[model samples]
Target chain A: MAPAIKKYGITVSIGLLAFIILVAIFAGQVAPHDPENGKLDDRLFGPCAEYPLGTDQMGRCILSRIIFGARISLSVGIIVVSASVTVGTAIGLISGYFGGLIDEAIMRIVDSFLAFPSTLLALGIAGLFGAGFINMVIALIIVDWTPYARLIRATVIDLRGMEFIKASIGLGMGDLFVILRHVLPNTLSPLLVMATTGLGYVILAAAGLSFLGFGVQPPTPEWGFMLNDGKMFIRTAPYIMIFPGMMIMIVVLAFNYLGDSLRDLLDPRMKMVIR
Target chain B: MITDERPGENRPLVEVYSLKVVFPTDDGIVRAIDTMDLSIREGEKLGLIGESGCGKTVFGHAIMRLLEDTTKVTGNIVFRGKALYSLDRESMRRLRGKEIGMILQNPGASLNPVLTVGSQVSEVLVLHKGLKKRTAWDRVVGLLGRVRIPEPERRAGEYPHQFSGGMKERAVIAMGIASEPVMIIADEPTKGLDVTVKRKIVRLLKEVTVEKTMLIITHDLDVAEEVCDRIAVMYAGELVEIAPRGAMFERQLHPYVQGFFQSLPDRGLKPIPGMSPSLIHLPEGCRFHPRCNRATGRCRTEHPEMIDTGDGRCVRCFLYA
Candidate 1:
């Protein structure tokens, strides 16, 4: 790819992400109407001067709702990614640094977790816990953490064999010290790339759970919740579903694009290939 | 430099008796070190020289108790009157870096690339000396400067990749000597450097290890000649000869050692014929018999024990016996 095109791709992704975050942060100011408040007379109204993306079945402004939906999606993504990365990295460091029966045991446990389809696992957990934002977050975290654990464990296993690690052990530094100072820092760049990539998936999964009626309840301005609210009126007025669906697609694509660019920038090996 | 009180001139600081290190791989057990015996006298610089696969580095690792857990090592390594292999984990950790420093082969690979050169060196001081990070860092700067690294303060802050190969070696050497360990075990310290750099490192090694006991493992005979008071030649995991450096260079007793010296560029560069035998499937009797020019029926049929030739020399050969 031409450098100019690559640079433009990065810029466009960053711009879209920034726009979404800004919309989320200033939703009240940015939205022309209150996302939750609606008029009974204007229910299922087509796109017009007053309602750009038209009103939902509840007469809620689809544009306003989509604007506010970014808040829930982004926060859920951030919280789940940070929490899972911390848990998985710690477990991975311990498992890889102390290989043997412990490594075997932890890896087998991770393998079992990975054996299940992630979305189905999250669905099962969310179904069991009942519908709520916190429950959905918990479910997403449970499924998401496994991949980070696997990724980090692989990285740690590679790093553990590095001559510097043996040198540290030979230098009389404790295993904990070596893992935290030497091994953990070295694992960070790859972890950052994984976390960025995983963030996009986490956001997509959160929206997926909400669409299935297992996330944020009705009347709450979430893109997935809006899609589910607009489902029945699809044949009569597909605008309600189309706008929120487009929002989800655009935001997810933006996150993934940004993540790819970040990986290319942060990873030295990738940098060589690109240049 | 606070020198430890010297014991008797002949007292061994580190003694290895009948050491055998085997790695049980999928193929078979690789007999890396087989029935080895060696002693480093107090304040003595002993060089262990050998071919690439001759287990010289294994002996260094065995001394430091740095071998892998799966490696089956059966031996007695006594350092400062304590059995090294039998020592508890905590004590063994305490003994390493604080009392015994190990300079590993390949300085570029050995130094942690992520950390600043200074912090890597100072980490030893903080761990063993119980010094605060600030003081440890200051001492690191001093150590780097002593190793003759220019702009020591600035260089200490830079990561390993920013430094050149020779500079990395100096930084590693500084780390080794940072804790003022009683003994230092260096594995091929001068391995992959230019001639001038190798000479500087050798001189630096000699100067820094003046009063401390040292074990140098190298394939470079010149390094051994320049840095060691005594030289011990290893052949296929076994010691072939032990003598003072000057005397060993003057006259080699074992046929293998003779061939080794003759293979040098100035000594007509007559390469020793036949490969060194595989460690896992070592030849019977003398390990070097197949490669010996003077291999006799007795040399092929019976292994020769180390025969003390007096004058602080021992040779493993039927001819000496």
Candidate 2:
């Protein structure tokens, strides 16, 4: 079990993720105070028996808000990654499988998108679309899918000529079935690794956008929104920003750790060395 | 049990008429198979023997239309009275694996590494035969049993990496014969296996492909002799000689064929002089003339056409002309 834990490295990360998820899911029941409702007298208060982690500028329970913020961050990470991976994988499969002119056309478009620094492109999209939840998600998705597409395309191109893929085709399997059953499954390990790592990036990007007031609105208690609100009281009340900032850092690190470990475990060549 | 209409009739199951396959590289067009003509009779096992890079595999790919679309293929490949080249992509795909199964050279690389051996074989059954999952699994285990794999039920559940070299080949053969194809194209079935394992694989392939039209491609004369009814010797990119297995061993006509036999360990270990000509810049006249002892001025200047020798044998040489 010790060796298995060391080999996988995701056990701790999975526990951390599960804890965060549980906190988010039970925020209403577990939170000591209402995230929205606040008393004027409690404003700028530090940790106490009644209000643990203290109250924010609005005198709302900062701990409760942060707990609720987990929901927003996790949802954004999951939804954005899901949408991008699915769309990107489909395009990559078609482009790499057919190749030739269709490949050329699709790849050139992917290339044009990849030409820009992704963050700058996301920023540009966010600026153009104006501040909103859906627009912010769209911006991140547009930027995020390029990596998945490129990774999947490269993998598909490498695997397209593999004997197993050719054998599947030779076995009279239709193009759709071959792509789904043979080509897609071969790309899964890398895709899984990419998605796990990409989840962290998505969460970070969503928070960045929200910090800039382009993501979930102020009243929503997202970690980024809390960070933005806390930035004002930094000198007088550093704890306000410290808590939300730590949450983001910890979640992102957890995903990164899991992703790295998964790469080691899932890679055939790497597994041999470890064993 | 999809049988040809006239099982005993004297009709060619597959006919290659002036078939040519050329690949365009950065340097120049590589003439892989140049004006090759041959035919495989129903239920006959034809051996395509050639050295490495001699277009034997390319010929098999051409028949299956497995080559990239950019490849320039010309002439006719008629299978069961239908011109294979004339068929559309979809129809051609349908013909492959179901009508003509192909076992590639390397079995290790042929089966999907991630998929279970059972799933790999069952995929063929489901795709071509439309068998349900339950039915495919039962048949897959039965097919594994037929290949003499120990504990077919347990072995089928294992991955390609879990199987040994010989077992992987057996699994690949199981997949190839899963659809019960009318014709099977096995390219280098016994290649890379040790002498003992080679015999076992040869015996296994021979057992499975019995009474089915087969094109077995290899450079091993002994394996060809053991399995093929008639052997077709390919030199450079042309069919130099094709004769019955017994006749090919007894009275080899083409100089290349003679050289190949002479180089065999049991024969003399006499290596053929010079190397196989590069497909990009093939030698003038006869491809084998540069190494031939009986080369004449005509052999250096004009390419010889394949001429019918008596007793259903054919040879390509100026001496024959």
List DockQ for all candidates: 0.80, 0.76
Deviation in angstroms for A202 in model 1?
Answer: 1.0
**CAPRI-style class, candidate 2:** medium
Off by over 4 Å in 2: A1-9, B1-9
Q: Which candidate tops DockQ? A: 1
Scoring only the A-chain of each prediction against the true A-chain gives TM-scores of 0.96, 0.95
Tens-place lDDT per residue, model 2, B171-233, is: 999999999999999999987899999999999999999899999999998899899998999
Q: What's the CA error at residue A21 for candidate 2, in Å?
A: 1.1
Candidate 1 residue pairs in backbone clash: none
Evaluate residue A105 in candidate 1 and report its C-alpha lDDT on the 0 to 100 scale. 96
lDDT of 1 by residue, B158-179 (tens): 9999998899999989988898
* TM-scores for every candidate against the unseen true structure: 0.96, 0.96
Per-candidate iRMS values, in order, are: 0.8, 1.0
